[model samples]
Target: MKIIEKMNIEKLNVIYQIFNEKDLLRKLSHQGIIKLHNFFQDENYVYLVTELANRGDLGFLIKNVSPLAINKSMIQFIIAELLMPLEYLHSIGVSHRDLKPENVFVTEEGHLKL
Candidate 1:
């Protein structure tokens, strides 16, 4: 999937810093975090080509599906799946500054990626 992040020219330096740290970004790949495949920029936006989450994000999915629709096993699975990457990030002194259901995605295979 492709995502475009827009920022003012003043924030250009921030984007460059992020892109320049490709090794750090690659090291962050895990079960729960979205993998960064490639990145580029034009005049106004930074383009990221990343893995596709066919099931979309967790926030919108929860809105459309009732909580009761999910069984005990599924809840347990999601919690278990999310924990590893969360722990791994923290262990490496990284904090997910923006963590919300919107930032978590579900794969077609019933797994979660943050």
Candidate 2:
């Protein structure tokens, strides 16, 4: 069984927590770039959870557009659009030390901002 809890401790971070059973599962779930759900055990395993993106990441989107010979303006727009999320993540005190296309998440809604 898992418990869903909101851990908003400043020390942990803007969004930080110590997950238990359910909490650990949630951390393991695939969520936003910084949004992670995790679990762990001393003699066993450590569960790192997050919100999984069924739609996948921006890198995949760019790859799919590769063969299309996309336009400069369009590419610029996409770049700008993609950067929006990055800006938010940074503003929120999160840094993407390792940023890749697969690291990004596309939600069900058309909106794209972490």
The number of the candidate with the highest TM-score is 1
**What TM-score against the true fold does each predicted structure earn?**
0.77, 0.45
Error of 2 at 31 (Å): 11
Which residue pairs in model 1 clash with each other?
32-114
Q: Candidate 2 on 1-114: residue-level lDDT in tens?
A: 112333323344523434332443333322233354454434333344545555656676667766656788766865676676567656755555656666555655533423
Residues 1-113 of candidate 1: C-alpha lDDT, one tens digit per residue: 54445565345546555564545666786777778788777777666666889898888887888779778986788788888888998998887777888888888886888
Candidate 1 wrongly placed segments (more than 4 Å): 8-23
Clashes of each: 1, 24
Could you tell me the lDDT of residue 89 within candidate 2? 55
